[model samples]
Target: MSSNGSVVPRVTTRTLQKMRDNDDPITMLTAYDYPMARLLDQAGVDVLLVGDSMGMVVQGHDTTLPVTMDQMIYHAEMVGRATDRAMVVVDLPFPEGQIGIERSIEAGVRVLKDTRCHAVKLEGGAEQADRIAAMVTAGIPVMAHVGLRPQNIHVDGGYRLQRDTDRLVADARAAEQAGAFAVLIECVPSSVAAAITDAVKVPTIGIGAGSAVSGQVLVTHDILGLTTGYTPKFTRNFAEIGKAIGQAAADYVAQVKSGGFPSKSESFS
Candidate 1:
């Protein structure tokens, strides 16, 4: 049973594969802290990613490049500790896994050992096949990210939609062949995402990549309307939680100023 007191099966890499095989959609959400991880897990989210996007969402950085391995490990540890069933996967922060095969393997090993996360996710496609293969060979389960990789935000100029059908399909196939248990496709057209999903044997998790893929992921803040500043085109605020929080705070302030908060029964004395 999970923290919610329900007997849902614990989600794992094999669970994700089974979902794909059975044509069941996988649900993923990004979580960086203990409270959020606990909530999402209890709500039965299948996977919780401690994504490097924490650089932007949590640390107030412009891009994910500034996130470090130490920061990732710290956050991953919190999420892993809080989660009872949802599989936790931490990102290999920029330049960590991209450097070399040995470095990549070392980073993956450290993430799994230190955080006790189920797996690690890395960005790149065919070019990253060697690193993915090496990590899997070393016993690290890898989830590959292709299409609009946020790690390449600077190089790509911005979060533009990926349209190259042949390349996207090839990347997905190569990652699967390289032993990645699943692949994440980001910011691509639905047609292209669908093709790639068909091309790969493993599950394809999409973010801004449309509905034809096997699964979907979104940053929790983005979906909850908690994100400030600019919101992405692909994001939909499922709940106005930020507004509700602000309204609650405003109500509390008004009650305190009017001396209406601690009257009669509200007093402990």
Candidate 2:
């Protein structure tokens, strides 16, 4: 219990390791600011990611790349302040992770110091394994992203899945070997996702990688049905809060128009 007599919230590396050891699924959702972060923490989300996806969800950017390190830090800090129990992980935006080992450490430290996130997630595979190693060695827990890397949208030619099993397995192993605590597999076949999880020691968290992986992660807006503008094939809508909210507002307007709302007893006298 806390000083306020509420149940204190806490998460640690041991908790994450227990999840991996028990094959217990990890739940992660992105939050850009305070209110959402607090709500997610209260709702028992295992991890709260300050993903660069915020560029699209909050800033209206077409891609996550256009977001700057400073912008990431600012949002991360906000989310961190609201987080008491959930493990906070912040994304090292596009080019922020591309500039080799030393730069990666610098970037990781800058973000970590600013936001106090439990770890930092970055996109890479065997090709960038050395950088991942360097970041890990520098005490930054890394969450590797494979398959459809949104930061490389131009090169991947629009978020396609990896069709080659051999390559995917190799990349997963590389990430694990490079000291990542977990890997995020995006837009890969379910069979391939299963194979990768079996091949690696670290937990595999899937976005579009299907149900075969160890755990699942979704952008808060995407899964909560808040995003009405677009939808992805792999994303499942558990609740359509957006539509419900719209309908509720419409109903309120109708009630007012018909003078059915704010009945005499309820009116401010």
Candidate 3:
């Protein structure tokens, strides 16, 4: 039984494969810390991706390129420690796979060893196939990210929708051929997203891409309405948690100022 007093078996790569084969949808959410990871795991999220987007979302960087391996390992460790059943997939930060294949494998292996995460996500498709294959050979499961790679934000002149269907399809096929257990398709049209899903044998996890993929993932902050500005087109705010939290804080401050927070019944006996 888990801490929530329920029994849910640990999710593995093989389990995800079976779910894909059975036509069940996989769910993933980005988690960067222990509290969020624990809560999401208790809620039964299928995968907790320790995304490099933490560079922008958590650390206030302009791009994911600034995130380092040490930062990723630190955050991933907390997420891995908090998870009970959900598979943890940590992002291999910039300059890791973009370098030589050996260094890339080393980086991936370090993430798995240091954080105890189940898999590592790399941001590329065809050019990353060698790194993906090498990592798999070295016992690190790789999840390939195709279309709208945030790590490539500099080259693309900022985040834009990727709709090159032929390139996207080739990348997905290369990643599947390279032994990636899953592919994350991001910021593409529904038609292109669906085409990649059909082309790839492995599970296709969509972000800004559409619903036809085998699974879906989004930044947890976006879904919870924690982000303040510039909402992505594909994400829906399921709850206004940011507003609720602000209101709760305001109420507490008002209560404390009025000395109502320490009422007779609230004091120690």
Candidate 4:
């Protein structure tokens, strides 16, 4: 049973589709490590995405550009092992969808076989139709991304809100028609996100895209305020965990300085 006293079944791509049909809101979060993945899975998140955002969240990098496939697989393996109920989907870091179908197939197959993840998410749209179709044909479950692709950051010049409704809707449709199990709409207007949701038969997960979609997702570190410094405007820090951690460290320092840390109960003797 889940913490809510209900049965927690293993989440699947089809499960997300069913939730969309039933008007049930889906929940997804990015988790790169085993401990956090376990906690989030136990908390009943529907999906745990091992996002390339780890380059920024874990590696202290300025962009996700430097993240490699090997790094992704390593983190994904950890997240996949820790998850029991949540469907774990790892991102195909930059160039996975940009390249040809043959290499993409190799990458997708490797991720599933090596990490034991349920699915792979690639950033792209209509242009990636053949790749998405081919990956699905290879027995790889694909989650397609549309609107404000992060891999295109250098091309886009920065992280800007995507507002092209017709294009976004077309991308979502193409991904669904190409056999993507779900479409993730990111950093777009709520109306556009909703249109994409309406346009596609599959489930639409959103990040900066708003609540009108079938589900929502956020960088876990950003949500818990564990990520120091700037976060996206669309993100909300549900708890000041970083502050608490800092306070805990400060308290320990104070205790040690005051000679009160080695109390009889705490001492080895």
Alpha-carbon local distance difference test for all models: 0.92, 0.86, 0.92, 0.91
lDDT tens digits, residues 193-246, model 2? Answer: 989988997888998888877778888888778885878888888888888999
Candidate 1 weakest ten by summed lDDT: 1-10
lDDT of 1: 0.92
Give the TM-score (vs. native) of candidate 1.
0.94
Q: Candidate 3: deviation at residue 141, Å?
A: 0.2
Clashing pairs in 2: none
**Ranking, TM-score, top scorer first:** 3, 4, 1, 2
TM-score of each: 0.94, 0.89, 0.96, 0.95
Q: What is the lDDT of residue 217 in candidate 4?
A: 93
Each model's RMSD to truth, in Å? 1.7, 2.7, 1.5, 1.8
* Candidate 2 lDDT trough over 10 residues, lowest sum: 1-10
Q: Which residue pairs in candidate 4 collide?
A: none
RMSD of 4: 1.8
How many backbone clashes can be found in candidate 3?
A: 0
Q: Write the per-residue lDDT of candidate 3 for residues 123-228, one digit (tens) a residue.
A: 8999988889988999999999999998887889889999999999999999999999999999999999999999988999999888999999999999999986
Instruction: Please give the TM-score that candidate 2 achieves against the real structure.
Output: 0.89
